[model samples]
Target: MAETEPNPLLRYLVSDPDAFAHNLAKAFEQAGKAAAAYLKPRETGDTDFGSTDEITRITKTLAHVGEWWLADPARTIEAQKRLVGGWMDLMSSTLKRLSGEPFEPTIRPDPKDKRFQDSEWNDNAFFDFVKQFYLLTSRWAGDMVEEAGDLDSHTRAKADFYVRQILAALSPSNFLMTNPELLRETLTSSGENLVRGMKMFAEDIAAGGGDLKIRQSDYSKFRIGENLAMTPGKVIWQNDVCQIIQYAPTTETVRRRPLLIVPPWINKFYILDLNPEKSFIRWAVSQGLTVFVISWVNPDQRQAEKSFEHYMKEGILTAVEVVEKSTGERGVDTIGYCVGGTLLGVTLAWCAATGDDRIKSATLFTTQVDFTHAGELKVFVDEEQISSLENQMSLRGFLEGRSMSTAFNLLRSNDLIWPYFINNYLKGKEPFPFDLLYWNSDSTRMPAANHSYYLRNCYLENNLTRGRLELGGVKLDLGKVTVPIYNLAAREDHIAPALSVFEGSRYFGGPVQYVLAGSGHIAGVINPVGKPKYQYWTGGPPQGSFTDWLAAASETPGSWWPHWHAWLTDLAPEMVPARQPGGGVLEPIEDAPGSYVRAKA
Candidate 1:
């Protein structure tokens, strides 16, 4: 409308002339007050800190009016001059009246009270208070400076004026205002949002103070002993950064055999193998299947040479060898969660590249293979951001865990960083403790090579989906490997959107069962028990591709684990007798869940 030269007032408010006049009159009055305040200037001078002694006493002595020359008559003399310049910039900018005057309080200060009205025409105590306060403050500053140590402040002008300007900006009689709606959401009742808010605020203060500290804790209800595997029931191998445990056989285990879990390095693997009853690892173990899980070594700065390819070569592939060597099996069924699944996909690519076909079947949980759909994370993975990250990785040799966590938190401010910041930083309170919060704070590091390559190729370039991505110099052709693939996508995952997970299905060229699980990323993958209210969606081998399957399948709500179990069992080898093959001795460690307990610092 403005571009069209159509008067905005004529279009939206031509019919309300009376309202226009009244509002316009009020606006002019406020403008006049603001302009008056803005034009009021002040002088500037010394600060509370004393002048330099080296440039001071001699300078004052040099300023004698009686001595403009030296004893030689052709003497040299120097004069000192210091110049300063700045402009005033604060004032009330609410509204103005047609008379170019501020609104005078014609009404009582409060209708509910009787003693607050003024009796004269220029009776605005607000502006009067401002003028009076500025005068007194300026005088008091000068009067009090001599009592202070070797310094001068009252000698400075505009010092008190700057403070007054700030206070004026916040006055109800002034312009700036607060957002009511945003403030309300954080302070409402019927939920702990209020409590959560206070803690976040506290954390901000603690963080700002540069003393922010994070310590891990043990939250896992499940535990195992040094003789846990030898106990004839269940077993767990605990490490400084991970806990590995095997479960008892279930009815479903009879159909499924040699189930091994591969979890991501970003966090502990126990998320998938949460507990005996709900643990997917335990569920597989109990179902008459031999289960083994790989626990990743947490690398600090010293061990930063590990890369994504290295993880595949030494981590997953080695775990497969260990599992096979112990069971005397040529291959074992596998399940990968999140980046674990990402690593699994890369491993398959590596296998195909090397003509090594050892993996029989694979399942991916909330794992993304095609990076194009990584959503908001895209903002932080452009070429520039990647370059910045590369420089950062160059500095640290890898991306630190806290750095990744900070990036993840920023993706969803309300859900992660802000809610607590408002309560803790703004409101000044302590952070309330929660299991999820505790887990979220427990972070792990990534190898610099892995971090840089993953960010550049997968995220910035979206190379995996574009068919432009290569792993360890080998074209990662997900379609070349002909192994059965199962994918469980969380219905409401922010990190790994379900549809994005489904995109990887097109890269695989075998029987693919894409299941949409009914939870967020980790919870959905870790789901075991047939929860009553869960839901899922499934596609088929005949659906052509992931694209075709989505077009054909209908949505259903319930635990999709049953269908997954059936699908995995159909592809897995039948169970064999209990036997131990050529395996390393059970290295006796300290206690059940030792390292993780330490993590619970």
Candidate 2:
């Protein structure tokens, strides 16, 4: 057994336990002081927990809950009936299976659900019983919540989320005893797997965080710019905020209108250029389009003042200038993804308002200009949470990647968090070498000012969609963006839900072409023409509601990438001889996926 490197944060604390205890004590003290202040009277009177009004309030709450159940007697009765019926069905199914008689399951797991994909679960009576029991239990919990109709919506949602967490925590897959496969493995391995699992658990805890990075199986396989981001290109322009990369041409003739990609600063740019097989940039270049991507700087304390405006001027606008200079072309086709799309939308509106027509056509990939329904991520954007985040960011001058990653992983705990816990810690099995998972673990820090401003303005207030968002001393109006716009959304995206992404189609004052890709946030955008896994949908025009559009749309058999290229090429200028990399006045500064991207906060 080899010892791995300890986390820097925990290494110091582990070496000096007394210092760690002191720090922990100080934290508790501060917490106590804050709690005391909150509970204490303004005039310095001693705090009293058992007041008449407080007791009366508690009694009233209990009375209200009782009244709610009593008043909805029929609903409660119906809920009980459903639960009984479910149990009966489960029992009947189990008996039939035990008797070797064919029985149809009352509740079947979704075909697309990967969790219960094992054929053994369906083939074996015991595994099927476990799965059925789990499903029934989950349904009963949901029903319990539904029966409590008297609770406020917020309280109900919180309860539901917590219940999901509880259920996920208690999943049979997490334990060797309940999980038949793991139990078999334990017996087969002579408990060596369990021993290895224990070692892994201790190693994870000592590292300060239990969240694993690279899979144990792929510990030494992948590296940036080697197995990943292997595209041939050069950084034609670099600034304090970002580096602009001009990808080398693959085709003899290129479209005069170059494509400029602005990926979210929340992650690296290599997501679109991961490998030769899946690189969207390589595909675009192969399509006879000169492509360029913006590699955002991983900001630190010194770059704390970098605001939304700083991203526009130094990030998007700078890239535009560099692209134009390199190709000797006035207009460039722009693609903004996620946060980058949000930034690009603001820049386009700013450009339209200021009469600066740099962008020929706009393409937004899973980008949300309107954050009114920004999905589950919105839960952590309230004033209280924002204030707490601001306090932490103020201390460090930037939000750490780990904090951000935790929040994101919470969005899909069953898929992202618990499975890893089972695989890495409980089962002690190494994770498969997944390229996307590697990219997902690779995160970046957000500057205090920029992040706070974004959370408050875009998420909390949703000012961007309302035409109230002011950037660079200019109020942005998304409707002013009249260029041919294409909006791409993922059907199964959690971060930027497809419907939320669809809303952008209505904001653009142009010929809007909205395409719904298959898969979630990353896989949807990265879906190639070759992948037979998923399909896409494209509707008539952005005329009615998203649901209506979805209903009216035609399903495409493969990737939406080709469809996007067709729409872009239709709006683009005539083709010309390929432009040499770094052929313009702005000379090449470094290589593509530049030094800024490799920097950790």
Candidate 3:
């Protein structure tokens, strides 16, 4: 039997078990040294003040060790050899369907499916063994204070502080140093990295560590267009994230009615309206779809008081009112992605719960209505992380785009985060200026109140889907939304697990279409036509269950955008004849894709 295709996330995770283990061990080792060196007794009041050379040596040593382990020549070859075999296994797994292997679900089937979560629970059980391996080493946690404890804190308070740091880092859950057989070897090469990280953090006040290189001046190029005027295109309308100017097309030119786009605040909105050529908004316009994108205000320390509720009011709702009033259109088709999709879902529910169904149809791209099985992120979304983020946002008015970007990057350390570090910091090479990275680095801040509320409610509490999340003083029951729904999810996305996203199909009633796209989190949405990229598959208009649908779904090549365009063309209000700027649906004074150009980070 032919093997089944490998899940990207799993492939990524198990890419090189040996190398992964090796890197982790090295990281640990470097971290250990970094910790020791950083915590080494500094002569109190002796103005040498810990020479920069000392601190930098520790950081470089840690980074060097981590990089070495991550890209170890022998390790890489071994990992590659292992992955080749794994790929064959993966291919064999994929071919099984053709060879008539009964079935193996892409995601663990819900217990409701009358089935176990996995066809192969044994492997998961093994991983569970690996994870739980720590508990087996109870002596490790209670083991003598290993590295930093050796430091002469020279005072009780200092010693206590050092002890507290050790306790915080060595919790049973974070006890990565346990099981000397498994991880310590890897740490041997990389342990100093961790310690160095701590010291750098400790000395940040003096070092201006605030220089988190979130935005690269030359990293990404934000290209401005010559056609500054908001013009009707294959799309209906467009808004700016930078909110540089407020210019909706003029009324006389309003023949092309507005279709407003709402993107998740978690990311810069330009992803949808990326650029003229690859721009989805532009594509929509070319198809004679009137598009107006909501360019969210990138908050700063000044905007910390803003709440999620305030955003909806000033964000989508406000945009709707402004567009409708300008174009004299009674309703608008609202499209959203990720957080935007969630927001869109909540907003739609609010409208329905309140009996305000002004929206035509709702399209959710890679958005999850349910948060169960949020995947690897569930580990990091701990209460403390949320609180730390909330406090940060409290002072900054929102979590800086860089902080959020860093968190997401960590999810795919080998791919997103480490590769760049290796390329730039390790090899002493400049990273090629890529627009996506630029956009990514150009992150926007969420208001403090809203960011905190979102993390606690959506991630930590998982309340939004559990029927507990209330927005704008309204209980956001997704079941309340009656609008025809279009949902897209990426099969390989670790960020929003497919199973979690499939839960959307159940929440939103009405004719629902869920399409599994070919790319990862961001690439899926950026899917352009003719990329000959990943194939998409769909189940049924009358979908049975997520599993049933997945099984019955047929595959389609290239991006889902074309299919969406076709589907949307069917749903789209017939295109009004082309009109001059501000002639029909547009108001001349407002902007096109406003508020998108600011330095997000």
Best by lDDT: 2
Candidate 2: minimum summed lDDT over ten consecutive residues — where?
A: 8-17
Angstrom error at residue 111, model 1: 36
Candidate 3 clashes: the total is 98
**Candidate 1 Cα outliers beyond 4 Å, as residue runs:** 1-256, 275-278, 422-433, 465-473, 530-532, 542-551, 578-601
lDDT of 3 by residue, 163-215 (tens): 33333333232323322222332244343333433333333222222232422
Q: Score each candidate by Cα lDDT.
A: 0.54, 0.77, 0.57
Relative to the true structure, candidate 2 reaches a TM of 0.81
Better of 1 and 3 by lDDT: 3
Name the candidate, 1 or 2, with the larger lDDT value: 2
Q: Candidate 2 residues 70-175, lDDT tens each?
A: 6777866766687788889989988987888988886877687666765656766667778878888888876676667669754455456656766887876677
Assess candidate 1 and give its lDDT. 0.54
Q: What tens digits encode model 1's per-residue C-alpha lDDT throughout 33-69?
A: 4333333321122111122542343333233321433
lDDT for 194 in candidate 3 is: 38
Off by over 4 Å in 3: 1-257, 542-545, 579-596
The pairs that clash in candidate 2 are: none
